[model samples]
Target chain A: MLATTIHGPRDIRVEEVPDPTIKRPTDAIVRVVAGCVCGSDLWPYRGENPIQAGATIGHECIGVVEEVGGDVQQFRPGDFVIVPFCHCDNTCAHCEAGVQSACDNLSMTTSGQGELARVGQADGSLVAVDGGAPDAALVPSLLALTDVMPTGWHAAVSAGVAKGGSVVVVGDGAVGLCGVLAASVMGAETIIAMSRHEDRQRLATDFGATHVVAERDRAGAKAVKEITGGVGADAVLECVGTDQSMGTAFAVARPGATVGFVGVPHGVELPVGKMFQKNVALRGGIAPVRRYLPELLELVLDGRIDPGRVFDLTLPLADAPEAYRAMDERRAIKVLLQP
Target chain B: MLATTIHGPRDIRVEEVPDPTIKRPTDAIVRVVAGCVCGSDLWPYRGENPIQAGATIGHECIGVVEEVGGDVQQFRPGDFVIVPFCHCDNTCAHCEAGVQSACDNLSMTTSGQGELARVGQADGSLVAVDGGAPDAALVPSLLALTDVMPTGWHAAVSAGVAKGGSVVVVGDGAVGLCGVLAASVMGAETIIAMSRHEDRQRLATDFGATHVVAERDRAGAKAVKEITGGVGADAVLECVGTDQSMGTAFAVARPGATVGFVGVPHGVELPVGKMFQKNVALRGGIAPVRRYLPELLELVLDGRIDPGRVFDLTLPLADAPEAYRAMDERRAIKVLLQP
Candidate 1:
């Protein structure tokens, strides 16, 4: 099998690697069918985070079960499944509360290189698709359910976007575009996607954003306020984790509104006094993607949401390094890799 | 008229001061019947906060309307009323949402001394004592409603102490003791009061606390977890605004629960990462006392709650500086002054 590895900053390579095998009773060995480049992957890719000599880089994936361990009862060989970025045993109290990202057994990659990927305490980590391997068209949708789509959904829902709320989505990344779609599906009456990129903004608009403004902070907030009858948006989805985006999200929301953030926070500090005075809530983290997979799959299956639209480029697994570069350079909104 | 002033940290004086008169359209002059010392006041009383020399002190009071401005319509000149520590117009969006502390025209303290108070936004700041001029038995309760008592109620309620939910009240002061009562009134299945003082703990038990513990942090959180079948309390009212107290509240709450905090945040800082992981909400700031006045007044009038029990010490208005000293020295659980 082939896997992508990061050698150093901006240095990505695809090479032959040992195929993964089931190790735990609850585990299922899945042969990767498709994986996509994630915005978070760029953290180490851009050297913002330390990178090991070689590390298995992808988390968002749709795969076929190659084998199942003895205790695995929900899935079988040849079944299609989606695997989330954060692995957890589904029965823990935190997982039960749908906060898998904070699951007691949750694991993350540090300055370590990968070996055979082990889905720890797998029962809650993998969501299986019905029956046989899924159709080719469903690949991006399945991969998305594992992270980006559900993450976008979490951002929208956690911001407490109601049926008729005016929502402002910050970030023009794939996840932000997906958030616009998620807000629309959740019945948001007005969706504003803040974007500077033409292609990404188009995706946001197509995803149901009623408006787009290539602005942030005071300017973006002012535009949103004007559009919202002087009351800011009811909810703001912060897909970018920087302090600037968080501030923009906070400033663009009305009193009693909330800001849902799915991006991994880095150097972001909350202004407690303002949040308290405005009565704004901060919700969302590494979204419990697994929790929303089933419902999201239904939406995708019913043709109600086409999350795959976020993918602007797709390459064979052999070109994973190029895919990373394309995304890192902002040349591709999302890169779908066939494995 | 006589007034209490903070000459410096740990220094106070009781002396003659000019009498207050209505100064705004919404103002009401009250001949204070009773007033009490507050824990927050000690921030300045202890010299922790920068208090100007000889600044008038007290904020809580219950009194008879001595005069009213042209627009004061809630009470007649002879009516008795409760003055919430922070006056609000009650008609602002925040006030309409029952968040009086965040009202657009937040009141600044006008009367600084021995009870006679000039309350701004009179209609919203004053709650009429319609059952008649309150009796001596109701005096303390009315004063309690002016600040600490209602603040405690707001803490318990914001913590989402649903009927039959298990609760933990942190803090040994009057507000914490009152929180135990508030939780009991809200029908919590078990009320655990965390206090070190035997007298305060006894008062907590008398006020319906099911259990009392002196432990805090992990020990206290562990004890509370054990008491709640190892799942932690359903609601934790943090009445101490210190970093440790906030940590204890977060550690002792079950997933998806709320930590209601009424203690004026001091050196306290929220553990944002932990809060996000726990999915526990931090709600309730300075209590909107006026918002709860109506309901609390009914409870007091109906003989369902005796918040007066928190007033363990009573002194002549002329000795308010001594009351402040006793409280600052931790010699008095709460001190009341009769004007």
Candidate 2:
């Protein structure tokens, strides 16, 4: 099997690796059909995050079960499935409470970019597609449910995006665009997308953003406030975890509004005093994508949403290095890889 | 008129001051019936918070309406009312959204411990007791509603307290004891109160704390986890605005739980990484006491709750200096002052 591995900064390669096997009774061998590059993947590629000499990378994928452990009851060979970024038993107190990201027995899927990957907690972590593999055209959308789409949905839910509410989505990356879509699906009447790039802004509008502000920092928040009729947004989605983005998110939130953050925090310090004085709330973290998988899969399969459009570039597994470069240089919103 | 004034740290004095008169069309003059020394009052008295020399200080009070300006519509002379610490117009967007603490036209009540106090936004900030002034015995309870009771209620509400849930309160001050009462009223099955003092623990148990943990820091969180069968509480109230208290609030919360904080933040920094990984949320701030005044008033009037019990000491108006000393020394849970 060939898998994506990183040796150092900007050092991505697809090299031959040993095939995965069922290591536990609850594990399954998945023959990955599709994998994608994430915004977070750039952390290591750009030297922003530490990395080992050589470690498998990638956590989002859709695949077919090639083998299953004896204890795995819900999934079997030949079934198409979506693998959540994080694996959970789905029965622990936290998982039962719908916070699978904080599951007691949690493990992340790191070899998804490989031809074959081992998935643990098979019965609880994998959501199989009914009736067998669908049309090839729907593969990207189905693959999205494994991570980004569900993450965006979690941000919207955490922000309390309710029917007839106004929402401001910070960051116009794929995840932020998905957040705009999620807010729309949740019935938010006014969706504002903060973006500085033309291509991303267009996608944001197409994904249901009623207004797009290309300004950054204070100017951006001022734009959002003006659009909201002098009062700030009813809910804010902080999809970019940076000090500047978080600041804008809080600045544009009306009193009693919540900011749901999904981007992994990097040197971000919360404005506790402002949050308190304005009665603003902060919620969100690693999204429980597993909990939202089943529902999101249904939406994708029914054609109610087309989250796959976020994938602006596709590359073969052997071109994994190019995929990383494209995302790091902002040449693509997201890159899909065929294994 | 006699009023409490602070010249500097440890310099509380009862001095002659000019009587308050209606200052604006939206203002009302109230003759103080009862004013209590608050946990926050100690901040200025101890010099932890900056204070101007000879400044009148006090924000919680129950009084009879002395006079009203032309624009004061809801309150009338001779009517008894609870004056929220923060005065709000209650018609602004934030107020209409139930966050009166962040009202567009907001002001703080600074002369509450005086014989006569001028309250701004009278129609919005004052919640009068129906059918005129009640018995003297109920005055303390109504006074409690002016700040502590509603602030505690805000903490519970912000923490997402639900029926049959478990709760942990991180402070033993008047507001924290009131928080225990608030959790009980919200139908929490298990209420844990963290207090080191015997007197406060006793009062906590009386206020409906099912369990009391005397440990501090890590040990306190450990005790709460052990009591909750190792999973942690469903909701947590952070009543002490310190780094240690905020840390414990998050430490003892179950995954996906929210920590509601109401204490005036001193030097608190949030653990954003831990919060993101564990899916814990933080909410709450200067409480919208005016929004909760009506409901809390009814509860106090019905004798269903006795929040005023937190005031364990009473002092004469001339003894205002002593009231401050008692609260500052932690010799009294709270002190009620008659003017």
Candidate 3:
């Protein structure tokens, strides 16, 4: 089996690795049909996040179950399913509360960049696509149901983006673009997407952004406020975890609004006094992808949302390094890999 | 008019000051029937929060409306009303959203320690008691409605404490004691009060704390966890603004729980990483006292709750200095001042 592995910074390679097999009573072996490179992978590729010498890469996938353990009653061989980025028992208190990402028995189950992967807690982590797999043209959209789409949905819901409400989305990555789509789906009347790049801005506009602010920092916040009649938006979605992005999210929210953030925080320190004075509620964390898979998959299947358009580049598994470079260089909004 | 003023740290004095009058079209003058010393006032009295010399003290009061400006339509002379600690223009977007404390035109209408105090934005700041003024015995409870009661209610409501849910109330001050009462009113099944002092613990228990954990910091959190079967409480109301108290509040909440805080943040810095990993949502700020006054007032008038019992000591207006000293020395849970 061919898999993606990282040797060091900017050192991604496709190498032959042992095929996965069910090793636990709650495990299932998956033959990945489609995988993708994430913006987060750039963290270690850029050396901002350290990586082991030969760590297997990729965490998002859609595939067919090749084999299932005895305890995995919900899934069996030959079934097409979406593998959530995180594995959980789904019966713990946190999982029952819809925060499966914080499940008591939680593990990052990333091996999607490979030809085959082992999924633990299979009964709880696998969401089978209704019927069988869809046409090849719908694979990217189905794959998105694994992570980015749900993450974007989480940001919107956390920020309390209500029907006919206004939302300002900070960041133009695939997740941010999806957030704009999610906010629109949630019935937000005004969707503002912040982007500095032409291509990303176009995608944002197409994905239901009513307005776009290309400015950065305080100026960007000023732009958002100006567009919203100086009162700011009803909700601000922080999709970029940088300090600047966080600052803008708070600044562009009305005094009583909330900032929903799903970005992986890096070097961000919230000013307690400032947040308190504005009465802004910030709520978001890693998305419970499994919890949202059913509805999102239905939406994708019904063609209500085309989040799959985020994949601007697709390549064979052997070109894994090039896929990473395309996304790392901003040449692709997101890259889909065929295994 | 005799009023309480701070000349410097530890220098509370009841001195003759100019009487307040309607200064704006939205203002009203109220003759205070009862006023109380707040834990926050001691912040400057103890020299922790700096104070300017000759600053009027005390912000909580219930009084008879003596005069109203032409624009003050909701309140009029002779009406017995609760003066919300924070004055706001109810027409602002924030006020419309029920976060009156964050209103665009906001002011802290203090001078409650004096015989007469000016209420700004009178229409938005006053909630009249039904059926006119009640017996003099209810003065203390009416006074509680001004700040502490609403503040505690804010903590409970912000934390999303629901019926059949468990809550952990941090801090044992007047606000914290009131929080216990608020949680009970909200139908929280298990209310755990964290207090180190016997007097406060007694007040907590009386306020409907089903369990009292007389431990601080880590031990207190441990006790709460042990009591909740190691799953932690469904909500945590942080009534103390200190870093330790904030930490404990998060420590005692289960994943996907919300931590509502009303204490003026003193030295609190949230660790974003820890909160994110646990999926804990922190939401709270200065209590929108005006928004809550009506419901809390009805509760008090109905004798369903007795928050005024928190004022264990009462003194004449001339003894204002002693009132401050008693609270500073922890000789009283709360103190009341009468003119």
What lDDT would each prediction earn against the true structure? 0.81, 0.91, 0.90
Q: Write model 2 residue lDDT over B35-79, tens digit each, in one string.
A: 978898888888899989998988888889999999988878999
Order of quality (TM-score):
2, 3, 1
lDDT top scorer: 2
A58-165: candidate 2 lDDT, tens digit per residue: 998889999999999998899999999999999999999999998888887888888988888989899989888879899889888888999899999999999999
Q: Ten residues in a row with the worst lDDT in model 2 chain B? A: B127-136
lDDT ranking of the models: 2, 3, 1
Question: Per-residue lDDT for A242-323 in model 3, tens only?
Answer: 8889988988988878899888888898877877787788888899988898899888888999999999999999999999
Candidate 3 chain A lowest-lDDT run of ten: A103-112
Clashing pairs in 3: none
Backbone clashes in candidate 3 total 0
TM-score of chain A, all candidates: 0.94, 0.98, 0.98
If scored against the real structure, what TM-score would every candidate get? 0.92, 0.99, 0.98
